[model samples]
Each structure stands twice: as structure tokens, then as C-alpha cells.
Target: MNFKPRFVALLVTLAVLVGAAGTYIGMQYFGDPGGQKQTANADQGAQNFGSLSEEEQKEFLDKVGNTDLKKVEQAYSVIKDNYVKDVDQQELVEGAIQGMLDKLDDPYSVYMDKDTMKQFNQTIESSFEGIGAEVSMVDDKVTVVAPIKGSPAEKAGIKPNDQILKVDGKSVEGMELYDAVLKIRGKKGSEVKLQIDRPGSEDLLTVNITRDDIPLETVYSDTKTVDGKKVGVLEITSFSEKTSDEFKKALTKLEDDGIEGLVIDVRGNPGGLLQDVEEILKQFIPKDKPIVQVEDRNGEKSRYFSELEKKKDYPITVLMDEGSASASEILASAMKEAGGYDLVGTKSFGKGTVQQAIPMGDGSTIKLTLFKWLTPDGNWIHKKGIQPTVKVKQPDYFYTNPVEIKVALKYDDTSDKVKNLQTMLEGLGYDPGRKDGYFDKETVDAVKAFQKDAGLEVTGEIDEKTGGKIEEKVVKEVRDDKNDLQMKKALDALFK
Candidate 1:
């Protein structure tokens, strides 16, 4: 993750798309200014970036072709001088930058104006207040990549891939990624209402989340006992500045305590510094192979390797899911490929390119995609995520939707809401009989049993209150450690 800066910038992005994702970032630099004939030493571990020497500046400008800039200037003049009304010249300039980025069609590549750039830098240097979730621009929609573990977004049931349609009653359709994120982020204690469009659901959901000071600490350590053996579980919520060091301490303590195996859980980690993941990978991966490979625009590659001569003696397993992304993916891929370990859970959130934030000489910044990161085995898992060796999906109730009660759901009623309630009932051991959205006689009996056990009215019909209680219980069950089948699978995989 350490880039030898070549004066001109191109780099491994240590930061998130900022406002879109709560993941933090730091500036990194590397470059190949083009114009010159770039040679490929594909096997080389280090690269001399296409010589950014003084003599090449003219060649670089010549290669850029002045015709495009001339055309842009022509358009600016036509609009500014002959338009219907006066225009903010600065706005026009900003629009030109944004327009060029839009043509690239890369959501990660964005323009951060003066104020936005300041806030973005501040977020990385310290902390900010928000709903604690990582979002991305997918198919032109602002979609939730993953909610931060234990954040308000996760507490409010904001799942990955939820397309945010509005924020605080305002439609964000066609809004820029930063603008949309700004609307969502606010001071702690302020409330933000989100209208979400989730896949596989019939109705759009409105989630009310109160913003809070998103936690900066990224690592959590604990122990799990399985089959009379102590196993250490390190859950990385994200890979921030202190993550790698924190991870080292946790691992050391676990080792000192004499653990049989380890579970590296990156289930809901959106992502952070690439360097942090690389630093962690060195602990487990042998030095024989490169930890990861970086491919630049000219198709030349730079291989990065760890100096470790040996791997850990104890068995290791990586736990991941759809919410796992970027640096999280890097760690999981390295463990599976180089360390010869097992991975448990569903596929990962694929984001393979690296970015660099370049100052535009005016307090503005252009966060540009610079390189594509390949796995140790040379796999580019861009849109295609890494598949787990052992895929374990959570219980059906965990993915169920909240019931929207317009009227009481009686035995004759049949709807998606009823089906969700049935799944919840079944998950909690209430024999709902059928789960196909049909509220049959068996479902009624199941509801009655649940109601009686909970000391409710036992009406045999699902009212608003009843549905709310059922949803609450379902969420609780989903959170319970005993019900975490994926963790169990990951731990078992370690032994296997």
C-alpha cells in the first residue's frame, strides 16, 4: 500500500468516496504522466513512473491535445456571452469538470469543491457526524454499500444495496453523490428520514435514522468457544488509521491467551486504508508470493510483497458477506489464496480500482481512479465479487421486510407482509405452517400462540402493534450470537 510518489499523482486510494461511504481515506501518490512511451517490466516489484522529469511536461501537454480544451473554451464563451442570463463563471468551470467525470462514468471519480474538499479532509483527519453507513453510486442511484457495524444505520435495519430515493422528504434523483451524501449526513442528534428502494421487496421503505457521532475505532476483538476449544474472533468493522496496529494488539493478546484458531470477520466492513489491509496480510501470508498486484492504465503491473518468511501456526478462517468490500476483500482474497485458508459466508462487495486525491491548485480536489488492484492470483474482482469457499446465508427471517399494516391481517388475507410475518413466526419456532404470503388457518394458530406467549390479546389476527412486536422479536433473534450460523460455519471451517 506504500506508493513511491512520482511527483505527478496517481495512487492507491486510502480513502472512501467520503460522503457516500463512511470509510476514511488518506492521500497517496504515484504517476505515469503519459506522453512518453511507457515500457513494461511486468515482473518488477517497483516501477519508475513514466519519468515525470521536466523535459516531459511539454510532451504531456502535447499528448493531451489542445483541441479539446479549445472546444471547451469556445463553449464557455458562447454560453457566458450570449446566454439568456448571467451565469456564475465559477459554476460553469465546475460544471466542466463534473461533465468530464460524468463521461468517464466512474462513480468513485468525483470533483470536490472548496468547502466539500475541506469537509472531506476533515473527515479523514478526525471524525464527522452521520448515520454511519457506506454508500456507493450504482446504476446512477445512491445505494447503500453497507451500514457501519453497530452504527445507527445498522440499528435501523439499513441493509446493503438499499437505494436511497429521498432524504428528509426531498427527492435525490439525479443529485450528485456528494450532494446526496451531504443531505444524509448531519450533526449528531439530528434526524434524517430516508425513503429506500430495496431489492426483492414489493414496497419502498421509509427508515428514520437519528444521526450520531460515527465511531472511529474500527476493530473489535472477542473470544468464542467451540467444541471445548477457545477460538479468537477479530471483527474488523472497517480499516481505518489505527486498524492495523489495533489488529496486531488483538492478535497478540489472543495468541498469548492460547487460542486454537482464529476467525477474521469482515462481514459489514465497508473499507478503508489499503495500507492497513496490506499490513494485516503480512501477518498471515507467506512472503513467497506477492500479496497483491497493482495494474496501471498502461497495463504495466507493480507487485507488492510481504517480507514474512513464515505463516501463522494456528489455523485461520475469513468471514465475509455482501457488505465486505475494498480492503476487506483484499484481506479475504489474500487469506484464501496465499494463506490457503477457508472463507465462509456469502460473496463480497466487489470494488477493485484504487484512487488518488489530487489537489486542483484551488482548494478543490479531483479524486481520480488511478489503478486496478488484482488479487495475489491476478484476479480482477471488479463488479464480480469473491465467492466464499463455504457460503452460508443468514436465516430467512434476517432478510424479511417489516410489515406495513394498513389493516389487520386475518386468516383469509395473503400478502408479502403476511409472508414476512410468517417467516418471523417460523424462525422463532412458531410453526407458521406455510410461508407463501398466505395467512391460512395454521398461520392464525401460530399467531395466536405467539400472542398468548407474549401476553398479547391473542386475537389470531396481526394488528399494527402485533406486527411491530413480531418484527422486533425477529430483529432480536437476528442479533443473537447463538443464531449466527455464519460465524459458527467460519469457526468450524478453521478446525476443518
Candidate 2:
């Protein structure tokens, strides 16, 4: 299927960073608090057409006298009447629509035909049938925001900010976020090949992932003893329909269990519904300040507040990383600025605008970026993400690139792949003798040691299979609690 015509552009994804849109009605705003605040006029970035609210409609109509669409109509008529080759009128019209959105330079404002919207609704409405990862258009390239936890994307070694070069050999260079997702989406058990440009790799990485039903559990909770105090850990994977209720239940249980503090972990979380995250924030943020402030195009700010009269008796710490975005960012900022809680971890995937899903009543939809949501302190954290109060990054091994082996790597070989292999070996407790990209005899011995322990033939050589195994072990080590320096710091921050 030529997905280009179906979906024009998108900023976020629920394929796990597509926009966090719920069921679309006439027009519903969804971003930070939920939905958009359309522009007052073209000057405010609202198009000459679409209006999600009555105010936007009135403003658009008021500008109707000043703006001339006769030129647009005349151009369309000229093209349809005089163009030598016949053009699909629908295609031309859609192109014009997308062209306008593209010129806005905002990927969040997008148009989706019925077919694309159906597929999109199917994914976000329920289980997604695709490579489990959240992606966004960053600097016009389709970048992986974060792989779904324990999904095909994560299993294939996909990481946050991975710029997707191709899908099944087709370059997605200029495709919209959703259009790229259409290329990545497939049936369960079917493999999808992705070529990615990761941050630190010397070359592009090629990964093959079998599509599957992505994880939707949303909330995970447990308790641990830190400083002789029971510290409750509530890990929010995503803010879906049921996520707020799940969080409430988890928090209730933790509070009932006599926890002295809480660690709210939103690490690697892409984003989700606004209501879900807002609800979760209300539980922590008191009435002293708004949990979030929504700024419209007219420089008007509307603050949303929780009715809670007091803060939580116990201290709270919010754990966030670069992959934590959208609604995750909402929670992180609110906790930091409004709730006065400590934020621990690296920076966030900055997305400060909210999008509105406007229904055409034909199952087609347009997601338009309209509002810029500010942090509680009126700080616009759009491109500038919310910085951590106590920044704690993971180990160097956690950020290593995949070891793509085109040829078997034997002793005396030297390349970037060899350097990656050495890092993994060292992370796994084997001594490779050198961190430089050189495969010495000690590196060969390290591979042999890993091979023997992994039950593979002790061939002292790193093959494609060996590389895959090494990547898998490295991912496991990254997920290990003992290696999670951020979580340790978060737990420790609660006490201070």
C-alpha cells in the first residue's frame, strides 16, 4: 500500500510517540491537559480553514474578508482544467492540505484519510499490530522516541532518538511520523527490517524486528527498602485509558503498605492520553499551584489545578530520561515545579505543544498543534526539555550501539563493531584488554569466554549470532536493577 497518500504528517505516535489522541469527536483537544487551542487567525498559526472551537471559527470567519481563497480556488481550477496530464482531484486537494500543514513546520498538525485514520485508530484504540516502538519526527527525520518495554523494538536493540533511515529498504527520509509508521507496521510474526542512524555509532545500524502486540500494562508497582525505610516504586509505562485508575490503585496499595516515600518512574515512557497523565498528576500536586499551564496562540495562559489542599506526607521523586516525553514530560514538570518533588535522571524528550484531533465525520481526522503547554512556573519547555534536579545517567554500557557483524570477527581484526563487542564483553565481566577498536588476542579470549558461558561453540570469533547474543545480554544488563544508577539515586533522593 502507498501509505503516503493516506496519512500526511504526525509529530507523535502511540505505535508507542505518535500524538496521544483518544476517540475523536467533532473536535477534542489532547496534548498536555488534552487537545488544542486553535489559532486566532493565520497569524497565530491556525490555518485558513480548520477550526476546533467556536472562537476559532469566529476568528477564521472574521478574517475571511481579509484573506483571499479565490486564488487557491483559481489555482486548483487552472491545474484541473489546463494541466496536460490528468491529476487525481482528491490527490491534488489532499496535497494542498498537507502542503499548508508542512509549511506550518509543525508535524503535529496533520491530516489522515479514512484508511489511515482507521489503521491509526485501531492501534491507539487498542492493541497495536506493529514494531513496538514510539517514534516522532525530529528535525524532519523519523526518530525512535522510545521502544516499548519488552516489545519487538526493544528486543531488536532499538533505542531512543534512533533516526530511521529505511524500512524494508525504502528510505523514509522525508515521510511524516505516521507515514513512516505505516511502513513499519505489519502483522504479528512478520519481520520488519529497519536501518537506523543511532547517536554514537560509527555507521548506521540495521535491525530486524518481528511485529507483535505491544505492551499496554501501563502501571507497575513494587516496594523496596532504602535507608531502612520502605520506598514504594510506581513505574508508569504509559498514560492510556486505564492508566490513571491503575496508578490510583497502585498508589493506594503503596500508601496502605506504609511506604515512607515514593519513586515515580517514567523512564523510557513515550507518552499517552492527557486525561490519564493529568489525573495522575492531581494525586500528587496540591492546590497551591496549577499542575500545568496551557498557553494559547494569543499569549493567553489557562492554568489547571488539582483540588488537593495538601501535599503528600511522604517525599516523592520523579524519575525521567530522554525517552520520557509528552505526558511523561507533563508529569515530570508538574512534580518538579508544582509538587516541589525531586526529578532524577537525564533530560526528557521535549514536546511542549498540545494537539487537537478534529473529526471530519467521515472517519478521517486532522491532528493540529494549537496550544503550547507550559510547566507550572510558566516555563515553556518545548525544545528545551525539563532538566533533572539530580541528573543521574545509566552506565556507559547502557548507551552502547548494536554490534552488527557483516563478517565473522576473528582475532587481529579491528573495527567499530569490534570496539562495541569489547565494550559488551567488558560490561558482562570479561576482560577484552583494550577499549580501542582493536581485536587483540585478549578480545578473542573474551569472546571465547562469553561463548563458553553462553553454551555456544568456543570458536574465539564473533559471528552474526555471537553479535546478536552480545546485544541481548547487554540489554538485559541495562534492565538490571543493580545497574540502574538513576533508580538508586531516585531512591536515595527521597530521603534527602
Q: Candidate 2: which stretches are off by over 4 Å?
A: 1-62, 65-67, 410-412, 455-460
lDDT: worst 10-residue window of model 1: 28-37
- Number of the top lDDT candidate: 1
Candidate 2: residue 355 lDDT (0-100): 76
Model 2: per-residue Cα lDDT over 177-267, one tens digit each: 6667767877778888889998878889888888877646778999999979999999987677778999999999999999999999998
Which stretches of candidate 1 lie above 4 Å from their native place? 1-54
Clashes of each: 2, 11
| C-alpha TM-scores of all predictions | 0.89, 0.86
